[model samples]
Target: MSPHPAPDPLAARLRDVRVDFGTRTAVRDVDLDVPAASVTVVAGPNGAGKSTLLEVVAGTRPPTSGTRWAMAAVAFVPQRAAVPDRLPITVRDVVSVGAWGRRGPWRRLDPAARAAVDESMERMEVTDLARKPFFALSGGQRQRTLLAQGLACGADLLLLDEPTTGLDSDSGERIRAVVRAEAQRGAAVVCVSHDPEVLRIADSVVRLVDGRVVDGHLGAGATEPQPA
Candidate 1:
């Protein structure tokens, strides 16, 4: 007898998906598949509805039409993360919030969960600021904290919007490393970014224009070196 068929590698699939806001149609008739263990970069000009597409996939916003198939667990880090500067929360405290989906509200973090959080913080290079106030950290530092939080969620699919925006070179590389590592671990990662550093590591590129997917492909051309 033949061996069992391989499982579907996709983490999410969209068919004729559209997103509308009042009179504005942000995204229209889009079909895309997010492959597991790969990095897909969504790139486009302003008002191209990149974020809206991400929202649709993340299930934060229901599509006005079409169908979506997604994994049960998804971790998303939005671009316009308005983390209050005066919140009086520690970095570790903020990152721990990501584990709540598994730990629940009333429960505490187990040793495994704690270890995940710690590892995420260290990977994002925010371990030194673990006890520091979230508001006291710089903008870049705050962004890393959020990224670490998303990583700690331990979701099979991760959606990141402009994860490396406004970060220094070193910080940007750190973010890129973590993102690549996630993809290597079989997470379907979709990121919206214009940063060259981020794009350099993509296994596939989804180009959008006026809320439409103009093109999507794998190994299109030359790419930068991967993390050591």
Candidate 2:
């Protein structure tokens, strides 16, 4: 008999994860596994702890209890609101910051890194805005720039919060395409979104309610791509 093939390794895992803030619990009793080369969408109404759970998976916020494990490199693109307005930084500067993880601070980007930044901006259709100030862009433009930054990171795991929250059909579809491409390239992608279009492209969907998972299953579009 032939030996069984090994199971694909997980990009991240959360076991009984929980988070608390003084009197409130943001997330609790959660267990999730992120497989490589796949997209997992977390969906829920407002205040359902979707963003908080994403932060835990990104390893940016330690859970009040439970365990979280993820790959070494991670790119987290938060909602545009999280970014301060009127920053002096340019769009190119923001995208280049992604490469800093590999090149470190105060160091010039190598030719390959530069190419990645340029390519990322192009992919997000932000090449034209490269010289523009980050704060000067509209909401959709800023979101695209941020996504380009995340793409430039070349991380094994990508985490995004409401990547397509508010945008025109074209911009939203472009982002969705990029997200699917990322998974195809072997990165584990986790997104917090309520967009029906987003849910349609996800391989799996985990729903949350009151800081706990209420449902988890294959997405409706798991076997095929849905029209944008």
Best model number under lDDT = 2
Q: How far is candidate 1 from the true structure (C-alpha RMSD, Å)?
A: 5.5
- Taking the tens digit of each residue's C-alpha lDDT, what string does model 1 give over 94-204? 899888887886589998889989998999989999999987888799899999999998989999999989889899988888888998898989999888777889888
Off by over 4 Å in 1: 1-7, 220-228
Give the Cα-based TM-score of candidate 1 against the true structure: 0.91
| Decoy 2 TM-score against native | 0.92
Estimate TM-scores for all models.
0.91, 0.92
Weakest lDDT window of 10 consecutive positions for candidate 2: 1-10
Model 2 error, position 146 (Å): 0.4
What's the CA error at residue 163 for candidate 2, in Å? 0.5
Candidate 2's residue-wise lDDT over 1-228, tens digit each?
A: 112322356788888998999999999999887888889999999999999999998988999998887887899999864556777889999999998886898699999899999999999999999999888899999899999999998998999999998899999999999999999999989999999999998999999999999999887546432221
Clashing pairs in 1: none
